[model samples]
Target: MSDVVYTTTHRVVVPFYVYAGLAFLVATGMLFTGAAEFSGHYFQPHILAITHTMALGWGTMIILGASHQLLPVLMEGELYSVKLAYLSYTFTGIGIALLVWAFYIFHMGWPAKCGALLINAGVIAFFVNVVMSIVKSKKENIQAIFMLTAAGWLAFTTLAGGLLICNFTENILPDGSLHYLSLHAHIGIVGWFLLLVMGVGSRLIPMFLISKYDSPKILWSIYGLINGGLITFIFIFLREAVSVLYMIPVLCVTGGIVLFGFFCRKAYRQRIRRQVDEEMKISLLAVVMMVLPLVFLIAVIVTLMTISADVHMVLAYGFTIFFGWLTAIILGMTFKTLPFIIWNRVYHARAGTGATPVPKELFSSRLFNIMAVCFIIGFISFVAGIVISNGIAMKVGALLLLLCAFLYNANVFKLLFHKDRML
Candidate 1:
């Protein structure tokens, strides 16, 4: 592999990823605990706390850290300022802390409102810095291209989220607060998280797999379909005519998935490293999980044609996306990415010396596989629990998820502390 020319001296961004990973671990743990409470009947505060804790605290935090590290490489220029990066982290951290506290402990009120505002401010600041840097860059890269678009969506996500928060306190929406929650969540999930993942995966997966079959066209197709579908969906759904409008975006999104699946298949076939790690193997399951929600949504739309689904069905679908698919992908990818990050930053310089270890030699794949199995079982149980309102199943599922989080964090810390290994 050749040296990636765009890298700069700033390694501060690396810590952000680590911090975000730590946050993810904690938030995931909280999610399990909170889920247990949800099992013991259902509490709005517990659900809200767990959902935001994972979404904002875990997912957004990691994305923020990764984007900071990626921008310089993609833009072919240094970040506009490291101080701004630090400031963004600080503000977001404070906001998340307060917001979580208010949700779990104090309910949605002034504290939650204030936290939402601050979180939105931090998000806006991050977007401004990133967008401006991209515009000012000397060269345009695909990673940067996807990121800029994703950042725009992130801004929308946060803005909508802020409004939702305000609605909790002040009833800003006429139809009630959760009327637009699906729209808000999907935009963030598909637009910001999913798009960025596909974009970055298009680049990194090939590199990591050591494959030469580059399909930029497929990537563009995925981008176009997903974003186009989102735009069309928003336009139609926002019109208050929910009947036919929902179908438009649903079809569009399915088309996007087809494009991505084709590309993923191509990449897998072309990959030189035939026998990959357990992480790669398990991550495949995540890709497969993507279809579950779509199938559920189709059923939902059809059901609504007769009679709409209750909140439980909606919650079931949401859990599948949030934990089943997205969380699984993140967990599997973290194993790969975290090891590489650790190796690159801590052990790369010492390579070929007797002291340094290879990246592959990092952790016990057996251990990871055990956790993955536990997680899958837990996830399935939890989804079943939600659908059937089985408290016992839900509690078991939460415990399993909690165990996975603990194992993941322990593995990460093992890598960080014992720097001799490639992890």
Candidate 2:
């Protein structure tokens, strides 16, 4: 019932946006250069570089920063240490830069190993900080548990990735290194990213809607379904089990998504604030996007059993999960969360004095709409290009996506530098 917003220091959050912006620029350039072509396989050097850029540089970076700010709010307590937060960011930024460079050049040398080590340490620091905060907090919530579990998965992901890197040098996994890549990717995507989103989104969506709705039971069910699915997946995946057994985790994750969709519907129905703003509307669109990867996964599984798994379908599935679902949610939530943080920093003290610009007034909605349209077009075109093997369509889609990234950065800058005016 309180409108209080808890956040970490600006130093912790702002640097993350800077890294995300740089990552977006790099990804757009990769797309423009055709390094991102579908090419019927997921494990080329350039593609790996691009994926790391988006995953580590943009997605994980933002999540790391935002979680520092959001966890205190979720836990109803202060961060364990501000200094640790800064250290985590520094190590992660350096690690990402080095790793990306190594991948770009197709070299897995000492530099890559060092980068992997640094990243692992950084993640460990972050995990420790979050755990400490959770332990110290008096208020307990399911959202906090979601975050802790996600952090644990992230640690597992990094450890697996480090082994993957080692495989290049030592040839540790003689069976075939590529086979383990799916485990690494899924742990990061579904275990870390999807679970974290569900945890955070469950709380934020209702709050933003001004809905007093609270369903602890529904949230617990979703948590159980996702983690249960993931645990089962790890067991099946490790044994190199039968193909059909894979469907079990897929079904569990699908159930979690369906339950989450129902939860969103209930929140919307209960919302006191009608006429949802453009920002929240975009966020809601991400909820729809969540279903897309499920559809793609079903196609992938069907093809796997019947026709030996089409490469294009597999690529489509990854594309939908990363770009369509994860990116959309991050894009939407960035606007919703960042503006309030900036507005509080700039105008909170001046609030009862004559007049002040509301948080919504900090940026241009027209620009947001343009970015949204471009993103949808680009996503659809890019997926179609992959489906049909059309290079030209892919190029066009990449260009549009590049434009969307530029517009997004521009708007972020606008909010960061908004000047106050007296009314």
Candidate 3:
């Protein structure tokens, strides 16, 4: 069906799309101006700011908005509370801004602590809404489970983050915030982002590919392995174990990812649709992009077995996950998803009546293609720069990424402001 089962009000969902677009532009700008920071420690001020901008502002914000609109559809029920969704947005938006600014200025005072607390509160609001929605739904699926679990993890991540912020000045944390940074990052990445993406992508990918293949058993297995891996990692982290101890969870998560890849392959092979769109192709490429980080991560673990880990490997691993795989998937899927959300607002009632624009036509494909090219070149160059500590390549890459971000924002805003027209 063209319409979502219970479509959220445009007022509720559109703001997120707009905010995410602006945040992406702002993040790229920071990336360009702060290109030098890429050579330094990941724990530095500007690096943290840019990371949060992409993570909370661009990534989490978009996911939150999409989830609010989609959960009801996936559950075949209504959202638990629109008010809660808006509350999550308000607190998250202001909190991200405060946090980003504080990080940029290297401020570890009230603004930082308050920002962290606000973000934690926002995650709580989201977690409550999601759990209640799942509980209320009569027919529950693995997707719902994945989402609810991810929400819980997000709450934990933010709570840890807040404590990390507090630890900066209070100095109450056991091993200093730096020691727990890996734990914080992994909790957010593996537990929250990866699981949530798998959940949403499993449903969306098959649907878009026109693959009739469905396997609850395989999905449940993926869920088990991924979460199992995450739990093991957290345990190892808390125990302060190093070397081969880390490998256990790493292998488990890797095994889970391998299963996921196999599942996607099966879906693709079983697909009834012969022709995939450009957007779908990019999304598929993103699925392939997942492999890069796995390789880098293995390298990082091996390096850790030695006296010191290679900083370049650590940075590239992170960059690959966030900017490479995650960004690719989001970039591809935004057009695929957002156009439909916007199209429903404009043409839901008139869909069967006359010549209404298809979701694909609401946004410019040319802009998307050009942006993809920029992303490809810039991503490779930026990674190569970081590996070799080449300032010139890094700056050039950032500049291209900034241009790509501009085109992306332009296309997104174009859809947001799309005028109602009858052809």
By TM-score, the best candidate is 3
Between the candidate structures 1 and 2, which one is better when assessed by lDDT? 2
Better of 1 and 2 by TM-score: 2
Candidate closest to the true structure, highest lDDT: 3
By TM-score, rank the candidates, best first: 3, 2, 1
Residue 121 lDDT in model 1? Answer: 84
- Provide the overall lDDT of each model, using Cα atoms, as 2-decimal numbers: 0.75, 0.85, 0.88
Tens-place lDDT digits, model 1, residues 217-315: 777888888899899878876887766568888888888887777777777889999887778766667777888888777766777777775556667
Assess candidate 1 and give its lDDT. Answer: 0.75
Tell me the RMSD of model 3 versus the true structure.
1.6
For candidate 1, the per-residue lDDT at 236 reads 70
Model 1 earns a TM-score of 0.90
lDDT of 2 by residue, 64-138 (tens): 988998999998778998888888888888998888888889889987888888889888989999999999988
Q: Count residue pairs with overlapping backbones in model 3.
A: 0
Worst 10 residues of 1 by lDDT: 1-10
- Residue lDDT tens for model 3, 1-423: 335366678788888888888888898899999999899878889888988998899889989988888888888888898999898999989899999999999999988988998888888988999989888988778998999999999999999999999999999887789899989999999988889988998999899899998889888988998999999999988888877788889888888788788888888999999898888888888888888988888888898888777888888888888778888888888999899988989898888876898889999999999999998899899999999999999899899889988999989988988988889
- Give the lDDT ranking, best first: 3, 2, 1
